[model samples]
Target chain A: MTGRVIVITSGKGGVGKTTTSANIGTALAKAGYKVVLIDTDLGLRNLDLLLGLENRIVYTIVDVIEERCKLKQALVKDKKNPNLSLLAAAQTRDKTAVNAEQLKSICDTLKEENDFVLVDCPAGIEQGFQNAVAGASEAIVVTTPEMSAIRDADRIIGLLEAKEEITSYKLLLNRVRPSLIKSNEMMSVDDVVEILSCPLVGIIPEDTGIITSTNKGEPIVNDEAALAGKAYRNVAQRILGEEVPFLDLDEPKGFMAKIKNAFAKLKAKV
Target chain B: MEKGFVENGFIIDLSDAKNTTQLVFELSSVMEHPEVKRKNVCLKLGALDLKQSQLLSIKALIESMDANLAFIDTDSEQTEASAVSLGIIVSEISDNLEPSIVCSAAEEVKDEEVVIKTECEVVEEDKTVEVHADLNSNANPIETAEGIEDIYDEQSTQELSEIIPAEHFEANFEALAESEGLIKAEEASKYILLDTGDVLPEGAEENDTNTETLPTLYINQTLRSGQTVSYEGNILIIGDAHPGSEIVAGGDITVWGILGGIAHAGSLGNVTSKVRALKLNAIQLRIAGLYARRNDTLNVPYVQKTNEFTPEEAQIEDGKIVIYKKLRRD
Candidate 1:
């Protein structure tokens, strides 16, 4: 099965790229597609941990590309989803360990077996950025509703266009808060879509579950009850050519939904 | 083609498999349209290939449909071959046949010494008017001809159409009235000069040494940490806008490289001033006194650290500057 190689990138670091990749990969795998999440951050790899497969990573992407191990040997299967896998980056290495061509070949190899290969790109448009994009046939720019993240996302989109890698790019607006958007304290998804000129792929709401999930080395998609988990599943469906509606960030809070949401939140907090 | 005709423009190839057949049809349809086919459309078709006949057919179809078909660049050998086969002259012609004809009127007068290509009346009708300035010198001659027919007075060179038609030219007179283009009128000796080749005056300044005085700020290299450049007029950055770098301009700000810094444009409270960049990602942007941070909330600590290094523009609206993506498509 020819898998679509998608690079999840944000020019600025720590804008939830790994989180987005892990969740989306898990979500897609849960949808029954054979998915592989390749962490291209190299030295600072966190996707394995985010997907709760860190301990299972016996071989890294560096090992696979460097011929120390085969691609299958380097792939760490997610315990939660038998179909999902993680090709962890070498934490001992830096962004320079790999290049775009190597990543492209790696992704090409994986494409023959997997339905989707998600390259979790390192933040910053540097060597690592080039390597991550090298293998990607499509790109998903992950950014928050903040001005800086949007700007960096824009810069990444520009570089992607300049490299002529992908004809069109998609934007994944993560960590958006409905209350903040309603209060005009934060940029709305509309505002971002207007400036970036890219179609909105997914809008992940601000959920503390993502943080807790990260701390626990489990992607939010593993938790079926979490809002973020459901959102990631929606994203996965959208990527699979399903016309799923975006998670309602602007929907007014109903008493029952709010109460259930609050109880869910309180239970998680406790 | 006259000066500025397809200068630095590319050729669009109509034969690409990746492009939708509908798009190719639309382009052909656009060429078939009488108005757009007359305009100088640059082509950059990359590796798309088409047979010579198909290209000629498209070109002729476009030329015949437009009133001003002077943009045809049939000089190249390949195009010349097609033009010969199509029975079309391989010369640059004005899109507006009228101005080209008027311009040619002067050329014919100047070239009186040489054998006239055709009778004056037929030349007038067929755009065969060629003028010669020097009668005695049999040396290289200046040729000016108009391909547009019936758009100008053949007898008197009073262009029936305004040099810049008042209807179409909503002159940026407010800003450029003092420019040489407007002042050239006053510098000329007469309010009206026919195709006699009376030289127009170099109004304002003949040399135009005022380029240095245009209130431009030149940034030598990429903007790095904590550096800021604020100007009342335009700001041109020769390098990248690195993270933590700040640039605030009352007018437009043009960044030549990756703009990964904070840029606040139209800071002088002008809504029209634009902030343009090759790559825009700003950490903090402020247009005028309005301010916006990369991420407004402290929820995501690690993301905030990266946000401080992102670049983008912050424009003022309703007394607040807000960060936005550099490319506003709608």
Candidate 2:
């Protein structure tokens, strides 16, 4: 079956683009789809590290493009999920080594064998970002609620529109703090969506479990107890054309606990 | 060569015409047709290789017969230019040529009607008005200075000489000013006013004196952050100007929606220009040489409260950009 190539990009750095790509790839693989994740960050390759497949990467995307190795030989298979594999970026090479046409040809060949190919894009609207988005038919922009991140996301969306190959795009609001949003201190999901004006793929709340999972080089989606893990699974299901309701971040535990907490606060006020 | 009769014209194809004599013979055959002579039918010349002089002679022959003619299917630019130089209207060289000529002729008729209506009104107001056939021509000499006495009897002249309304005169003056590019239109009022001191209407002098209407650029979508729009003229946005988006205009800026970005209106140092917005939450604003940042302590006038937000306008006051509510004009 032919796979759909999707790129996960955030114009601003440190906004969980790699994490979102890793988790979505893993979640799709867990759902029994053959998925391949390519880290197009070039010198700053980090998708393999996020997937815990860093040790297995003997060859990289540059090796395939430069004819140093076969495309299959460069793919590093994940330890946990046999269906999930990664084509890591070359840590020594720069972004200019691979052009859009080369990556597009590689993605075309990879789509013949895998069900999904997710490219983890590099930050900034530079050569690296162009290389990452060159092969994808769809884009998922990751951004935080901050002004700077939203501004960069806007610019990236404009660039993506200019890239005629990417026909559809969605936004993934990462690291959302529902408490701060409720207190009117931070931008809400609606505010971010209104400004960005893109369809929402998923909203992953600010979870500490994401940090622990990153330390272990394991995507948080593997943990059933993690809220962010569940969110990524929901995103994967949505990508599979399933209508999954968004997770209510304010009541992460249970609806009963949320009501009881509200009563307690009202009692204290009285 | 093929000669055929079509509706309202005859199509004489001179694709095989090898000499100027053959070309003239083909044009003469089409012009001599009874259908073409009975009415002022358009003779469409097709694929002719005639020289400029030959074409001009053929056009003169067609006009001598009182039949309208046009070079309708010419591929040569030289032929088209020759026809235009000879004052012969060249219909578009396309498959459906008749409708294009008809459409342009209809437009000319409409323009002439407007000119006639304006001239008629001017004549009725003042019999001294001299009507020019071509309003766009710069050489509009007065045809006659004979007053209302020449056109009407004494009784009718008295009725027609009743005071012309000021509004109609102003419209006529504006039209004249636009065509003449004169500053006299603004001064025309001072000469017409009785010596009694009455304040001129608020916007009347302003419109006349400001002859150069500033160009305006319109943005109908939200300007997101990181997007900077710099215009050499005034800017009008129908959507929100989000934070981090910068708009620099050389003239006044008007935002129909919320303005939260950095706006520099009148950037070329025109201090009288202002920036108006429905909600002025701008991070920084500059009008001309004056600058203003969003401050919590500055108390400005005319802050109107809406349902949820307060709409504010900013203008240069006392050499600084000050935020105020939009004053109701009425």
Candidate 3:
């Protein structure tokens, strides 16, 4: 069966594009769908490490595109999930090694065997970005609350619209701090949505577990206890055409908890 | 039988034709002529008596031959309406032509000349009415063309006002300066012959006649960081200017929303120019050659005592940029 190819891109670097790709791909595979993640960052490849499959990669996307090996020979299966696999990038080669047409052909063959192909696009509007976006039919732009990242995300959205192949696109805001937003020190979700003028698919709050998961070479979505893991699952469900409620940023309070909060406020006043 | 011939181009008179079928057959034969092929010709249809569908079919036939068609000397509104729908130009012969012979022959070339002249006049009137409607819909009162023309007329005798020079002032002045001089010469003669209104008294500054007019650019959206807008004239922004974004203007600058960026007004050294914003939390402000940074110590105590956010204005005073609370004028 043909799969849906979705590219995850952010025009600015260090905005969690690779993190979102790894988590979404893992979460989709956990739901019993065959999924493949391709790291298109070329020289700075990291999707293999994120999936804990770095040592298993014998060949890469560059090898498949160059015809050095068959497409199936380069796809390294994930250690955790049998349905999940990864096509790593060539760390020795640069972005120009694989052209857009070559990537398109490679994705076509991958689509035939998998239920979803998540492309982890490199940051910056360069050849790497063009090659990653050329193969995808849908896009997810990852951004933060900062003005610099949001501006670059806007520029990326414009470039995506110019591509005739991409039919649908959505935004995913990452690294958001709820306390900073409540204190008016940082921009809120509504502020970003208004400026970007795109529908938001997910909001991942700033969590320390993401760092821990990254160090362990595993996506946060596998932890099952982390808030960020739950958020990634919700995003995966949304992509599957399921209506899921967003994760509440504020702590959930019950009836007795509300009474305790009121008494605590009154005691502080005295 | 088609009663018309090809003089300058093909002319078909449909008055003598019996029915729509006969008209279509004859027009098809005219279009197939070897002389009409590969030439840009105006095929004139004179005084047709066919229905709208019949006219449409003839129009389609002419278009297939790649010839431009002009419907002339038609008395029926249905034929004219059909021609218009096909994007064909229509003209009516004047009353000077003989009524019966008007549709019978093509020798009376003088009537076609009169019809062409009247068509041009009708198109000109239609264009002016459309322009007037468009000018009324835009929101800016200053840029609207309503009283500005009257103001230009009333001040014709007075010397042109002095405009503060900026980088674009040279190009703008060269384009407008010569045209205004020519208008003044024409107006002076017309007013002298009419003997209306007093001319300007002597001793007015002759250099003022060449002053340039400054134009203001309006921006309606927020400017994010890494964006910079520089203009040779004034600028008015209706949205917020975020930090890291910068605006440089040759004259005054105004922001209707929050201003958190760097703004430099009167960059060309017009010291009187001012900068105003609804919420001025700018990192840096400059007017003319003087510059000032936001004083955190000065703002903290003021904000605590007032407990209300107030708008601010910045201007050059005593060769330095000073910021103060904006006072309501009205």
Residue A212, model 3, lDDT: 76
- Reference-based TM-score of each model: 0.43, 0.44, 0.44
Pick by DockQ: 1 or 2, better one: 1
* Candidate number that wins on TM-score, 1 or 3: 3
Residue-level lDDT tens digits of model 2 in B137-194: 3522322122223222332333321332224323443353244332211212111111
Worst 10 residues of 1 chain B by lDDT: B184-193
List model 2 lDDT by residue over A1-270, tens digit each: 889999999899999999999999999999999999999988776776577654345458998998867899788788789999999987656789999889989999999999999999999998888888888999999999999999999999999999989999999999999999989999999999999999999999999999888766789999999999999999999999999999988763778987898998899999
- Report lDDT per candidate: 0.60, 0.68, 0.68
Over all chains combined, what TM-score does candidate 1 have?
0.43
Instruction: Categorize the docking of model 1.
Output: incorrect
On DockQ, the candidate that comes out on top is 1
Docking quality level of the chain pair in candidate 3: incorrect
Model 3 lDDT on a 0 to 1 scale? 0.68
**Considering lDDT, where higher is better, how would the candidates rank from best to worst?**
2, 3, 1
All DockQ scores = 0.03, 0.02, 0.02
Mind listing the fnat for each candidate?
0.00, 0.00, 0.00
Q: What lDDT score is found at residue B314 in candidate 2?
A: 66
Of the two candidates 2 and 3, the one with more favorable lDDT, higher being better, is: 2
Error of 3 at A176 (Å): 1.1
Which sections of candidate 2 miss by over 4 Å? A252-259, A262-270, B1-330
